[model samples]
Target: MRFATYRHDGSTRAGVVDGDVVHALPAGTTVLDLVRAGLPAAVEAGTAALAEPEVPLADVTLLPPLQAPTVRDFVAFEEHVEGVRKAIDGVAGVPPEWYQAPTFYFTNPYALVGAHDDVAVPPNSQRFDFELEVAVVVGRDGASLSPEQAREHVFGYTVLNDWSARDLQAREMRVSLGPAKGKDSATTLGPWLVTADELEPYRDDEGFLALDMRVSVNGTEVGQDLLSNMGWPFEELISYASRGTEVRAGDVLGSGTSGNGGCLAELWGTRGEAAPPPLQPGDVVEMTVEGIGTIRNRVVAGVDLPPVAPARARPRTRKRPAAS
Candidate 1:
């Protein structure tokens, strides 16, 4: 079952996406709340609640399908590294230990947006790009979990548009603070969240590893890469991420930009060069990870723009040094 958070009638409600239409769910429908209530049982309840007919997806806007109690992203692909190696300082294909451990970040939870919405370009960005990849939504709360038990904690999965502001990202990294301005503004998620049970037919040692996730600007296919191509596997990411930390139900763990070709920065090279494709106001970006779903967002001219300063993560999980 596909789930979503949405807005309609001047109010926000959550719903299950059925086919192309979304059946309105009750308000206060957060993935975390549902997970803590009892994952599989909660999903059963969300499904049962959808029995009462509601508005069609066409009639309402899909907000970020999740209100992740915690939003953490990890660098888990080798393709992305190999692609940007030459451009970045001393960086090249899967730096030795990078694949051995899952690298993660704690991003702003409030700024996340929904699919098909307009992505606001912040005042700080001159170079904006899109990253198409799959992300997992945790279903059960646990810590120190084994790889064998990890699958039980995943409620579903979805596609993500890990938009980037290249210039700001580069600057921040020099200060040993990763993606200060580089990852701000809008992180688009959703269209629908595909449940774990639904994907039983595709499970393997690499799991979703080999599935092709594609992206497009306006209407052309950029390139397609297989999830199996990842340098780090999902199981490794989940198991390692849970160490000494509480990964709650509804927390989203993003598989950082799939491969170098997954985003414009890698595909087009930085500004002083020819852009394979540069995004501007009015351009539409769409990302689709097979079995997960698609995320479509349009670029729009930003307003007066906020300060662009990064927000402090709540409760502040342990902070890792940026230089490592």
Candidate 2:
């Protein structure tokens, strides 16, 4: 069953989405609550008593599937990584360490927005871009989980658009550490959550879901790829994330940008820098994963704050020996 947290009758509540109609689950239920209970069981309990009325989806305002407890985004697609490397560094290859394990980064969970919401371009970002991907929501708590065990912990899937500020990211990545302000501005997830059981048919022989991922800006298509192209699957990502740490219910794991041209940075690097300019105010970004639905966000305006200066000392420059 598909589920969502949406605004209805002046209050936010959790509901099941069916045929463009939302059936209220319970008066105070939130998608996070259902995830905490484990999705299948929550569905059984929430629908046991069907007294609440159903509402048309068009009448309600949708929210992110849940207020995630924590968000971890991973780079599971090799083609995307190689393409991005080629674009940024002008050489194409995935790092050797990437093959050894799935690597991920913790991002701000509080920055999430839902489908149809307006995303604010962070201050000082001249190269804002969108990433087309899928996200998995955790259903159970576990530490040091094996890939097989990790598979059981996933409650559902949803489309994720990991908005980015490429100019900021490039500067920060050069310091060895990764994206900070560049990624903290916004992450879009929603339309609704499709429970794992609902996608049984799409699972490929290798266990990766064969979902078609697509992204478009304004009215033009920008990126498209199949989830099966990912070198590592969600189970591997979750298992790796659980190593030496705890993954709890409501935690979100994202499949980092799919497609060879997922974001503007990669596109600009591959094509001429003059083409596919960075996102501007009022640009509409729509990302969709087959079975999960689309998340359409409009770039509304930018934050007025200026970029913060580094407080630490700069690297010392070496002097040539007596100007040889």
Candidate 3:
């Protein structure tokens, strides 16, 4: 079943999505509440909501399915890493450690926007881009879970757009510390969340979801890739994430950017002069993952803040006394 958080008549509420109609869940209930309730309960509640009055999907404004407790984005696609590494680090191949285990980084949860929200080009950024990804929401809490055990913790999936400011990212990563401020602007999630069970038919024998993913800008197609191409499946990513750490309900795990032109950065690495231009104000970005849904966001101009004070000059070293 598909679950969504939407605003209708000036009030925001959770609902069960059925084609173009949405059936409201009880008031005050959010998608996060349903995720924390566990799958069976969530399903039961959704089933009950289906009997209530229907609201046209177009009449309500969609919101991010849930406000995640934490967001961990993984580089699960080898092709993405290959292309991006070349462009960002001037490297040629995927790092060996990336194959040793699934690697991820934490992004700000407060920076999230709804599927159709407006995203501003982060202040001081000129090269803005969007990453096409699929994200899974955790249904329960677990720590140090094995791959087999992690499967049970998945609640659902949704489309994610990890918006980026390449210029900012490049400068910060020079210090080997962050993609911070670079990615601190906006991360889009939703349209709605599709429950895990509903996607059983799409899962392959090896546990990878054979989903088609695509991204377009201003109605022009930018890239497309298959979810099955991921170097590490969602289960493994989740398992690796739980290594000595807890993954709680509503925590989201993203399947990085897909390869075969997932984002402009990767395209620039592979296509150089032919790569499309970076996102600009008024540009619309739309991303879709086969079993989940699509998320569309528009870019807007950002207000620049005053420049921060530069770092202090290094202190002069004192001359030391000669040792005996």
Highest-scoring model, TM-score? 3
What pairs collide in candidate 2? none
Residue 265 of model 3, lDDT score = 90
| Candidate 3 wrongly placed segments (more than 4 Å) | 316-324
Query: Residue-wise lDDT of candidate 2 within 1-324, one digit each (tens)?
Result: 888889977999888887788888867778888899886687795565244677999999999989998999998888778767665555667799888878889899989998989999888888888888899999999999999999999999998889998878877887889878879999998989889988878999989999988888898988888998887889888898999988999999998888666776667666656368889999999887888898899997786885586689857769745864
Q: Candidate 1 — which pairs collide?
A: 22-57, 79-260, 80-260, 209-227, 209-228, 210-228
- The TM-score values for the models, in the order shown, are 0.87, 0.92, 0.96
- Candidate 3 at residue 254, lDDT? 95
Q: What does candidate 1 score on TM?
A: 0.87
Return the lDDT, model 1, position 60.
Answer: 87
Please give the ranking of all candidate structures by lDDT, highest first, separated by commas.
Answer: 3, 2, 1
Q: Cα deviation in Å at residue 184, candidate 2?
A: 0.5
For residues 103-179, write the lDDT of model 1, one tens digit per residue.
88887787788989898776657777888878888887889887767777777788878887776777778787777
Please, what are the lDDT tens digits per residue for candidate 3 over residues 62-81? 98899898999988999998
Backbone clash total for model 1 is: 6
